[model samples]
Structures are given as C-alpha cells and as structure tokens.
Target: MPLTRRSLMDAAAARFGWRRAYGDTTTVDELLTEQSEAAYTEAADHAALATAKNTDALAVQPGVLDTRGRILADVLSLEGVLAGARSRSLPSEVVKRLEDVVDHGHEVTVLLAAAAVRAAAAHTSSGN
Candidate 1:
C-alpha cells in the first residue's frame, strides 16, 4: 500500500495509543489532497495529547520524563512537516492543514490525555 488518507489517519491514531487497524490502499492523488486537512488535524491531535500527558512532569511526578520526551518529538515532527511543505512548495491546501494544529494545540493535548486515559482503561479490562 502506497498511502491513503485512512492509512495516514490510522498512523496518527496508533501514535496516540489507538489499538485499531487500518486497511491497505493508497488514496488517489486528488482525494489525498482533499483530505490533507483531516490528516493534519489527526496528527495535531495526537501531538497535543502527548503534550498533555507530560504537562505535569515538573510537579515531582515520576515517569514523566519519557512522556515529555515523546511530546517533544511529536512537536518536532509537526515542525518538520511544516518546513518540508514550505520548502517543497507544496499546495496551499497542504499548508492549510497545519493551521488548526498550530492554533488549538493545547486544547487538543488536553482532549488527547482524556482519550488516552479512557483507552488505557479499556485496554486493561480487555486484557483481563
């Protein structure tokens, strides 16, 4: 599979602790372009989620360094995407995807943390 919007979204979901699966199929170029904003939103959501998880690291919380590192990496990845798109002169639509990711980062992170907690509960129960 080359890469589809679904695959991209799946990758983002998995990065944020989603246990779901994705199918194999590359999306057509036009569809992929159309879904660029969705893809970026997903990535931004995951990045913010990671950030929220690590936000309390300075409060004498143990085991936060690792998560904080993960958040840092996610932010870096977002920056890389923006830079790459700009340098390559990618379509305006592609660049437009990052707008929400940059703007609502903190809110997304908080939401992500809540989602992670829920997923953790479900995972634990399912394993039992």
Candidate 2:
C-alpha cells in the first residue's frame, strides 16, 4: 500500500516514542510538525534564496553555500538514521517511513540546488 502522510507520521511517532506521553495526549500531527520544524525552515530558506532576483555573486554565494552545506548535512544525517534503524531492526513499515521522508527531502534539495546553480550561472554570465 502506498504510504500517506498520516502513515508516515504514525510510523515516526511509533518509532520515536512521540506517543508515550501520559494519556497519549500528543497528537501525531503535532509530533511530526515539531520534528519537522527545522527542516521546514531550512527548505523555506532554500526556496527563498533560489527564487531571489538579485544575482550579485557576493550576495547570493553565501546563501547558496549555506544551503549546500545543509543539504549535505541532511544527507549524512539521513544515512545515519537509516543505518541506526537497520541496526535496531526497526520494522519495515518504519523503515519505509524514514525512506519516504529522506526521498522527499532529497527531491527538494535537488531542485533547490539546481535553482541555485542556475542563479549562480546567471550571476557569472552577467558579470555581477
């Protein structure tokens, strides 16, 4: 079965003990949202930098570099998560959830990286 966002959140909640609160008061959406806050912020930053109009190399380079570094770090962190999940013998469903999250992150990062490259190219060609 194809995994839905709810399933992913459920799996994460199960795997991470997010549902362990007294009376199970914490909702899956809240847990997922809390966990995703940093990632969402970084993604938003990447989108803004990618879509920015000003092509000054000096101005844009720092944002591009920062995005690149974050992407690399995310990749490494995902790898570690997968490795740890395997070592811990996590259920296949949970593993799939992790993979799905990583896949989406990769897609966003790739698009953002492409846009940053194009922006950088435009800056270079414009002699900015």
Candidate 3:
C-alpha cells in the first residue's frame, strides 16, 4: 500500500517519541507539520533513494524511450527535409545512409524498451 501523510506522522510519533503532553497539545499540529516536512526533505536528499525511485519510474514508463526516440526521429526527419530542400547540393548516398541508420536505431530502441519493461515486471513481481 502507498504511504500517506497520516501514516508517516503516526510512524514518526511512535518511532521518535514525538507526541505532545495530554493538555499541552496547542502546537501539536504545527510540530507535526514541521516534522513531516523535515522527514520528507531528508528523504528527498538521499541519493540512493532518489536513484532507486528514478530507476523504478523509468522502468515502468517505457514512453521514456519514445521521448528520446521521437527526438532522434525528428532530427532524422529534419535531415530528410533539408536534403529535399537542397537535393541538388546533397549527395543521395548520404541521405540513404542517414535513413538506414535511423531505421536501425529505431529497431534497437524498441528491443531495449521491451527489455526494460520485462525487467520492471520481474522486479515488481519479486516484491523488490
């Protein structure tokens, strides 16, 4: 289950003995908010946690591949457009080679994206 702010606050109070006195709870809300913000800030600054989250997010979002692929495809498309606009100056062989490379790059990206999806599925299934 996903962690919630209330759960985090409860855990913090339990783990850190941060509870207030029975009748001195006037600032409890402010104190809890401060504690939660501090905890979140600390967690966010942890490099290993940040990296793990990023890896997991990337694994689950295969569209990341499309984002990069789209950039490459657009660049290639631009090359084609430029070639057409200056067909007299550009060599046909260069354009052909560019197209070939773009096609091969796309095939490779698809394979890698598939592999990433499989790895992410395996990771989730294993409860890691």
Q: lDDT for every model?
A: 0.61, 0.73, 0.64
| Model 1 alpha-carbon drift over 4 Å, by segment | 1-60, 102-128
In the range 6-125, model 2's lDDT, one tens digit per residue, is 567667899977643423545655656765986898989877766775446546656666777798789778978888998899999978888887888788778767778887787789
Candidate 1 pairs with clashing backbones: 48-109
Better of 1 and 2 by TM-score: 2
> Tens digit of lDDT per residue, candidate 3, span 1-128?
12366557668888986752433554566666777988888967765654666666445455556555775677677667656745665677756776676677666667756766776777788787
For model 3, state the Cα shift of residue 48 in Å: 11
Order of candidates by lDDT, top first? 2, 3, 1
Q: What's the CA RMSD for each of the models?
A: 13.4, 8.9, 21.2
Candidate 3 lDDT score relative to the true structure: 0.64
Off by over 4 Å in 3: 1-89
| Residues 31-112 of candidate 1: C-alpha lDDT, one tens digit per residue | 5665786789798987776677754323223333345456656766787877888888899887878644654554555555
TM-score of 1: 0.33
Cα deviation of 56 in candidate 2 (Å)? 5.6
Error of 3 at 89 (Å): 8.1
**TM-scores of all models?**
0.33, 0.53, 0.36
